[model samples]
Target chain A: MKPMLAALVLLASLGVPLLAVAADPLASPGWPIAQNRFLTGKTYVFDDRVQVIVPRDAEDSTAVPGFVRVQGIPDVQQIMVFAELNPIPMIVQFWPHRLEPNIGFRFKVQQATPVRAAALGADGIWYIGGAWVNAAGGGCSAPSIASADADWAERLGEVHSRIWNRGDEGRRLRLTVMHPMDTGLAAGIPKFYLEELVLVDDADKHLGRVEVHASVAENPTLTFDLRTGGSVRIQGADNNGNRMLGEVE
Target chain B: MMPRLNALLGFYALLYGSFAAALDYQLQPREIAAGVYIFEGRQEHFTRHNGGNIVNTGFVITDAGVVVIDTGPSRLYGEQMRKAIATVTDQPPVQVFITHHHPDHFLGNQAFADVPICALPLTQKIIARDADALLDNMYRAAGAWMEGTEAVAPNCRAEAGKLTVGERRLSVLAVAGHSGDEASDLMVYDHRSGTLFAGDIVFHGRAATTPHANIQVWLQVLRDLERQQPQILVPGHGPTATDSRAIRETAAYLEWLDTTLREAAAAGLDMAEALELEIPERFKSLAVIDEEFERSVFHLFPAIDQEVLHGGAGNGTR
Candidate 1:
């Protein structure tokens, strides 16, 4: 009984089941862990014409491999898709259905997070693909354009978009917002953050919304595609009810 | 006890030798071109150990007064530059042009307190806000090399525009994409010598540093410089190369990086893998290729994607 008691005491000294000792691999100093935490549940099929390719180790921050395939989409046509986190959450959507079964683009991860891509097939089924990114540093918390509140306030409602013609019916549209999509990480003068909510709408239709991260670069630019010719509008508002709008043609 | 004492003395000597070696700052001033000089110094920091010597403080003796381009890394170095200039000319340096806000080029401005210093407006703002941080980094890097000195600061500022000194026409273009502040372009047209002082814009034998750099806009600025076609080019660092070939080479290097990194990014290659990929044939033999290439690639990969893929604006003017 003495020996058993002594063994128990040794175990206790070794910090077994101590509330203070938590198992957190990420908390270890200088240990390399996955920086991107993007997770995809299942490959969602939009239509028989569209094929989505998702990478296996999407958790790695430095690499994200993906492929997109769509049947009947003409080759040489522009392909547009949106990552769900865009202030519009539409990463890059473009028009004129290209026939190529594959399209690819490389993007920086603001954090270890998941990226969802939604492709609008010619048949109108939103094919969805997802990838995770492990990136270093809090990219979303990086500083953006330094402008006065009054100056940023004046350009609230103006939305602008530039549609590039890939030489034919294919069109690539790039959109930008004039609002500060404050991610609540930055300090404004008296230790306050410029937190705000922004919405992107196309022709009175709800496109998507993004929880603005402070790490986004100033004048957050979004490039996407649309099969239809219509105007897009962006609305932004801070917690204080300051609002601004912009339009793209 | 005697053996132990001998071992202890050996250890102390080893430590002292290392400390003394690091503290020694070797600065060599080479006359690369006629009436043009480059004060080449080593960056005494671990972060900048790429063997890319610090090329700060260049002097051009003009009919009016000596025109110094870039003020060395610190006040002491700046004084060294002034002394070097005095060896060649009796006239005081009337005007100083800061190529950018990098501490190695601008902190020494304090050495020329009496001389009027000029830089792009953006550079002035960056120096005003980030100079302290830059100096702290320098001090930490120099360690024993700067054992007995305080960091110096820039005194005068230059608005972005044109200024004429002697027969030279200096134009401060607001080139950005390198630092938040500092001109992307510093075009000095020396009518007498037909030379253009192309700051850090063109590196002759080494890959360019891309921290806080905008590759696309930098390429555009190079194109603009090429169009001017100055007879001689005096780079901010390294030996000057004649004609716009250096400009083309620098642009080509950037383009290769842009395309290669873009492909790697598209393929979902990790940053480390991308860096490990064999360097192109063009840049294989350049000095500091292996030492600094990785860092340049790391900074440039994301910057290029931001500008080209994301449609981010060029680095200059906000």
Candidate 2:
């Protein structure tokens, strides 16, 4: 008991989620057991309010599609996605000005990794959602299409949004932005992509959001699980001063 | 365990489609001219949703039987095309003409196995060479749509000349400059109806794909095609055009792309800078313009840059 207490004190001082890991030794690595800038030192309870969708076997490693949803939370300010296997790790770090609900997006999954999404609330607590993405080869270094292609600039900043009721009392919202989420791995290619995405309801109610990473595929896509069904408003920004707003009924 | 579960679910979906809803390949062709019928495919890229049905395929009913212009993207599309043709005319397609070696032009040859699917010898050779890689990419882009699709090479050789089909005289010519399969992309000029079944050589509304285009040579081919002065020109991808002015539209685009890529390469702008280069406002209205231009620049611009500046023997993704 003395040793355990000492370890807890050490972990608390280190600002890690080691206490959560210590509470359940059998917990998966995805159960928030590491240090995060937004999640460190904050008392966060494990809640199903945040959910994620990851493909078990992604056919195209370069564009592994996934979705993250955050609901039943108030005043959410930011969200971040991290792929454990990526060389750079954090896929996206979003600072959405509008409180939009959820996002479905594609990731440049380098290899098989435990991908996690962390949502930061106004109360300084981060809710986490995670899944495992299995891929055969490297999605990061495969001569990404964003930087190598010359016509990406003309098509940049175009946004397409769609909303559909899953019919299981849950609605889904998907948004695709035409921007090369460059990971800066390729020679001569700069790190350019959507940095943040925010979702809001018809009443301008703040919902779930996420920050994007360069590991995201070109023409970034975001899908979200909507707890409440109605008109949805999406807002996102990129490394370039490009802001796009979309509405889906 | 997850993949196993997914595999099991896929098996069940295959066995019992009623449990899970899937895409239905319902193809219906519309008659554009007398005997020349065209199927306007979905105006989208090859994806899981579109199921690879993104190529314009037409069929002409001759006195002997039906002559198909180009098979679609997959065996399923070709099979459905056969069924669609049966609804229009009872005669089966005697000769299936593959316009080029593009998968959209040949992969559906499996559906017309009984018929003599004909193409240029070079086209056949390139298709034979790139069959495996092409099918692999197609399967990756379209999962279930390529289930039964197999790469079936064109068994019959089609020559450049007036082909006598029963009573109709159809003049077949080669137009090579659009893509890699040089001298393989063929055009069929119907003398009776004044319709030109122009393959990938001419893109009307869609931004032409320029993966292996010799733009200068392509320009020359367009001028020659315009000289034919066909009443209707059915392009490989988009809607059919009635006037020869469509040829100029395609030529202008190719010339612009060639000039832009050369200029960018000469200006020491790398592929990254070239990608960010401004697209002229005129080509913005073309269908799939963004995606098409990006793909062309990715595959072509860097090589042009190297050939012009670096003196390196650049590699072009074939």
Best by lDDT: 2
lDDT of 1 by residue, B51-142 (tens): 22366456777678888888766565676667777877787889888878777777666678887787766666667777666776566555
Taking chain A by itself, what TM-score does each prediction score?
A: 0.42, 0.70
lDDT of 2 at B227: 85
> How does candidate 1 fare on TM-score?
0.54
Q: Give candidate 2 regions above 4 Å deviation.
A: A1-249, B1-22, B311-318
Indicate the docking level reached by candidate 2. incorrect
Q: Candidate 1 chain A: worst 10 consecutive residues by lDDT?
A: A30-39
Using DockQ as the measure, the top candidate is: 1
Q: Score the docking of each candidate (DockQ).
A: 0.04, 0.02
Task: Tell me each candidate's TM-score.
Answer: 0.54, 0.58
TM-scores of chain B alone in all candidate structures, in the order given: 0.80, 0.90
Error of 2 at B268 (Å): 1.1
